[model samples]
Target: MAIIKAVNSKSSIGTAINYVSKKEKTEEKLISGIDCNPITAIDEMKATKELYDKKDGRQYSHFIQSFNPKDTLSPEKAHKIGKEFIRNNDKFKGHEILLTTHKDKKHIHNHFIINSVNYETGRKFHTTKYEYQAMKDKSNELSKDHGLTVPEKTKEKGKITSFNQNKYRVMERHFKGTARSYVIDTALAVKKAQGKSTSREDFIKEMKDQGYSTNWTDTRKHVTFINNETGKRVRLANLEKTFNDSNFTKGGLTDEFEQTLGRRERSRGTKSIDSRNKGVKRAYEELHQGTDGQGLNQPPSSLKRDSGDRRGKQKGTRANDFDIGRAKEHIRKSASENARSLGELSKPDARTRKIEQEKARELERANRRELERRIERNKSRNRENTR
Candidate 1:
């Protein structure tokens, strides 16, 4: 089986080009370079992109296409298949590429460093979900043509093992028996805890008590446990399917916790709104009493000073002091309106509604500033008239 994976190159294109085309891995440049010197080819590719003003942050698409270690294909044959795969694919056409095969590992894998910008069209390559599928299909086709063994396809899609899995596998294969033992022991302990604990918090606490540290949070998708002594972080989901966070929900542990958490959050939110509404009501009443003893039924405009007393008040109370009081009244009204509006939003949609609430507050602030400016102008005009 051949697996292909693409990585976006953020570092220097020349550096990646050199690393893949190194003499030690590529048999002293004999097994490297497609049409020209690999380094020169990449430099020219970059220059071509710059000439067309298509140079982007992503300089290249680095791909690793590896065959099964058990496969008996030669390095030269594997390199040819990789080159053909890139040439035949419509997604990689008209692009400068460097191909190299490494013999350092048990499996024969090809590394491809292709320019992002197409030399002919000056357009960058677009990646999609189907790209990996296309690569695998092409690889399988080429393997069949070369009389190589092709793994049978199953009705159920197999899980793709992650790089971390392979890394740990190598460590386990070598002499790191203690680390491997720690991982297995921790996974078994967590599984046992999952069966007993009714809530996620309880399970995590139990795991910590048993000498494992959990970094699982409500925001995280997966739970990770670190071995306290070894400091090795292992993803619970990666260890076994039954130990995954999704399984906890299926087994009724996380579901119960989530429902309980939701109710508590809603209760807290309701109490917060009630407290805020009371504060707003008290502030509104104070503003009404302070502003010339006006009633609550009167509009904000009615709080303006009389033309005769404006000059006297302007001397006694600074324009800023009057504006501050008016601003406070506006804030209280805005808060009350926002609180009522939020109360109508569904609990599930409260986060989205908060953005709208912020926009409304900004609009209210703009109106308040304009009203304050008008009040200040009126006071200035009254003072000049009195002069």
Candidate 2:
């Protein structure tokens, strides 16, 4: 099996060219070039790039085609396959390419450094997702043609990110032998609770139900969890990297709470949007029709998801704060305008006081109306379910 990867080299063109074609790693016999000389590949590529005036940014593209160690393919065979793959690929036909097969490692890997500027038309070689995936497919097809068996492809793990990697790796080292690990146990419990709970308060209650005490408040920078039975206390940050998800870090839980609650703080918690919209529309119609903002008893009817679905389910939508705030502001302005249109407000006295007061009154009535509407709707559903 041969796996292809594109390398985004940060070093300058010359440095990258030297590293890939280093004499100790690969020999002149195993190296070849396309539209450029392998011995002077770097100069040829630089000259091509300089001619096109595209030397300001990227100079060349580096691609690595590595074969499986178990394949036991000879350097000559791998080099032949590498040249064939590149020549057959339409994306690199017009570009200057340097192919080197390195035998220093356990597996033989072929390196291809293609000039950025095309030799034929001076056009810069650009890579897209489609082109990259096609290269992989072509390379794999050739590998299979040579009677090599490709292993099943698996999801690639994330590369080591620059941020706090060393610090997190330190914690990961401490978490070795986690079979009876206390901190690991707490993190598992925290993730379990976060999966089910929507609000910070709900999360806290869920943790309590699991017999874990959390100092996880919005104001604090770090949360510490204490196992009730084991009496083991550990800061959330001290846990392994896998357990330390962004949702349970710092004000993450509170941020999620604020988003989930959305415009439903007055109703204690938020429900599915499908039901919320219905309640809001019903309340608006009732307020305008006859209730005069009085008989509105419908808050949004919440459809509780099955508890079984909540367990082990981590995926959820995060509410957009800007849209939610805009929606809330729209309601207040709309209520104020409606009151004014009905001639209920006097510009002299009500301009400063009564408009705000009327907006509040209408909103309160709408909320109450929704609450009552949901209760009646639930009773009806329950009666049918019993039947």
What overall lDDT goes with each candidate model?
0.65, 0.67
Q: Which ten residues in a row have the lowest lDDT in candidate 1?
A: 154-163
lDDT of 1 by residue, 1-387 (tens): 676665544678888877887767767533544433453566566665654566766787788888887778788888878878877888877676778888777898899888777766778875643565677678778878877765443221222222234444543443334544555566566656665565777888888888899887878877788979779888765664322122333223454455556777899999999999999997766554533454455454644643557656444432223445677878999999999887777575786778889999898677656644543454355345435
Candidate 2 clash figure, as a count = 11
Clashes of 1: 0
Model 1 regions more than 4 Å off: 28-39, 152-154, 157-387
Candidate 2 ranges with C-alpha deviation above 4 Å? 154-387
lDDT of 2 by residue, 234-349 (tens): 88666523332334454445545665565456555444566888999976554443212322332333112323445756364222113444467889999999988767555666
What is every candidate's alpha-carbon RMSD to the true fold?
A: 22.1, 24.2
**TM-score of decoy 1:** 0.43
Report how far off residue 160 is in candidate 2 (Å).
18
Predicted structure with the largest lDDT when compared to the true one: 2
What's the count of clashing pairs in each model shown? Answer: 0, 11
